[model samples]
Target: MHEKDHSEALKARIKSPKRASRRMSMLLGAVALGALTTGAMLQSSFDVGPTPAYAQNLSAQVPAATSAGFADVVDHVKPAVVSVRVKVAVEGASAEGFDLRQFGLPEGSPFEKFFRRFGDEGQRPAPRRYGEAQGSGFFISADGYVVTNNHVVEKAREVEIQTDDGKTYSARIVGTDPKTDLALLKVDAEGGFPYVSFARNAPRVGEWVLAVGNPFGLGGTVTAGIVSARGRDIGAGPYDDFLQIDAAVNRGNSGGPTFNAAGEVVGVNTAIASPSGGNVGIAFAIPAETVQKVVAEIKEHGAVRRGYLGVQIQPISKDIAEGLGLDDAKGAIVARVEGGSPAEKAGIKTGDAILAVDGHEVKNARELARDIAGFAPGKSVDVTVWRDGKKREISVTLTKMPGEKTASAETGEEQGGKLGLSLAPASSVDGADKEGVVVVGVEPGSPAEERGLRSGDVIVSVGGKKVETPQDVREAVKELRKEGRKAVLMQVESANGARFVALPIA
Candidate 1:
């Protein structure tokens, strides 16, 4: 996706695959605002994913540079970096849309005038129009296979790569995975090409790192910084494990490489957090661990397939922990179990707190998600969940993730008293769940609204007890509060599907 402005605090984000990494855009007047835009260095006008462990060479590249400098490392890996340019049909925009900001080109880019000559994006020209997207990439093999962000070549009519020697060559897309925001492109005319390897070890936070790629069309730009942090989720995608750095990552710098002291590619620059849509010393990169795994799949299968453990999940908050009769707020609570899913087949149910997977302790929701995705389809694994105050283990066979998951899930009836909800028996409503109470209304600025409850939502149960009417719903809340529960967990079924929403009792 292209760069977009944030009107408020990182509240909403607009992005599509194209050229360059994205940034957070919040239009803050006197205060601070935050927004996130993506499509990192070099074009599908810039859009950019989680990855598995990539096998890489562990041999030292001139040893780790000392505090003195990174001159040796930079000299070794710069040749592998290249500027990626994708020419798409003038009107060949993605279903979402595209614009100059999406392209992330510099002010003096040669094609800017031509794009404006035709007409505004709203007004299409009679003749075919040709627009180009640019970002960055580096060769992964001597035979000329390059790795870049998927947004760089999305909907591309043709691809052209510019090497360090100022030579341009045609390339073809091998495979692109939007989930990981990574793509593999092969150069047609193959000779021995300058290539780099993914880092064998993850870089430590505060360790020295270098970023190399095209920024604002300036090729071979090099900047140095330290790994600011690790395991950052920028809400870029479902699998959003990014490396945070302090390097100067700009619009045209997306898809570039971030290297550790060993001259190995540790990450691919993908996004930044800035209010003005420029560098603010804060940037994001897809870790080499994910990159190597994703690149390998694309090279071999021409597509990426991830494992799926179907369940609607949310974090176990402190209040929820008290309600669930647990001492600590850890692991992920199953809000809803997908019908006919591997989870459902394994006897997993709503309100089950997933504590471990295959004996590995589950820390939270994100950890569970990543661990599940790392597995291959058809693999049977042990899943342990805390149910009815005890941990039970079940085996589940994972399936291939579907394009779109249909929700078959729970919500509860409402009582306007303390919970600020109005309710009716489901039998009283024409099109409602057969066994629950319907939510007729939610009080304004009420706890129900804060938890996403709305009219027409069916409340199936409260505190694990089924409720069939307004009185039943009221009794459930009253009983839970009397038991010293801080919140009430309600199984709600709405238009989207059924899930659990916990509302505070105080």
Candidate 2:
């Protein structure tokens, strides 16, 4: 029924939902006038109608936002949003190039080669390829500074933005942070630009939000929804603390602004969790808290300078907590302390559980990483860690994170009895440990394998003590169990990096 029918029905549902009997004044949510490019609407008008008395009663009971309305909010913020267009260079080619085929337009079509002749003034640049992409962004200052996604301008050679009023202006990339997928752009005209500010607080779950963007290159479209959740980690990066919203964000909505009822930008629309590229009501946005910080740094330095404490870490599991005598499975267990890093200088060793930083409780590895990164480099803070059944505070002065790397591990397999781990001295194994027992193998379905120990993982320490041989590991484990501990913690170094694993001594 699609193509024509699909366009007709979508128009109907959006433009003319059923009315109530109580004579409610209708507010047209949004209009995409003359916006249909790929298709046109044949059935342009709908038959007017009224609903039963029950429909009126139900409508009355609904929230009064119908009366308060989003039109005011939309009017306040829509002008700040612009449709950003960029001539993106081909993957490897210079920014002054384009590959039309790679632009994700009409795939498998002959237009690929025909579009290459996009030369104006009888001058075709070199044989390099170029493509164009469009997304949404908003001005954040009266000086014409715009905030958008890093992906919108990454590898962009020429950038221009068309405002809601159809006026286009050339823009320059001010700065970009790919880790947060946020980019700042500057329009260099002398006139003051209409702009919006970031919301001081994140929107609460179920709070109303309006997403304004240029979907499918359609100008200044608006959709309404509520905040679905917060602190969502979509694995986009180590700093991923996205706000989940059930909004109709689409492809061109990337880098657009999601505003609160007060017309303040609450989030920057980023990734959509949909199987097909279209929106399925599950979209993630970068919270404005992150945006304000990142944009501020970008404005000041033209790059984000994040505090670094170079320690590879993993979340504390229940078994690991029990092994370390922790009351709860919280905090991040330091796996490997990078040489010369703040963690190393602070005497933070492998197997230390980082419980808090500057009195802020770190609930997990991601939080700890994010918290540390939030600080400026050269900032000194107190990091609390649990070691040897006690908590101690260590002062660390952070340095600029050279390059961000978050620890992620995938398990593999065979091995022994007892703890289901076959162990040998590091000296006996090729390319093995200088100060620990090497895992020769892991038994399938055993505790060792379940806890993610692999054949090549060098067990560096048992029960907080460094072990050079398999016999030393056994002795340490036996001693820890003799103290009535149900689990033993071992520092194991794998190819990914060093991490702590808890194996049941029982």
- On lDDT, the leading prediction is 1
Task: Show where candidate 1 strays beyond 4 Å.
Answer: 1-60, 66-68, 92-127, 404-506
lDDT of each residue in 170-283, candidate 1, tens digit only:
988777778678889989773567777777789999988898888878778999899999998766666677898998877777788999888888999877776556667788
Lowest lDDT sum, 10 consecutive residues, model 1, at 31-40
* Residue 458 shift from truth in candidate 2, angstroms: 35
Error of 1 at 155 (Å): 2.7
lDDT tens per residue, model 2, 252-333: 8888999887778889997776544566787788988788877877776666767778787878889999999999999888
Q: Which portions of model 2 miss their true places by more than 4 Å?
A: 1-68, 91-126, 404-506
lDDT per model vs. reference: 0.71, 0.70
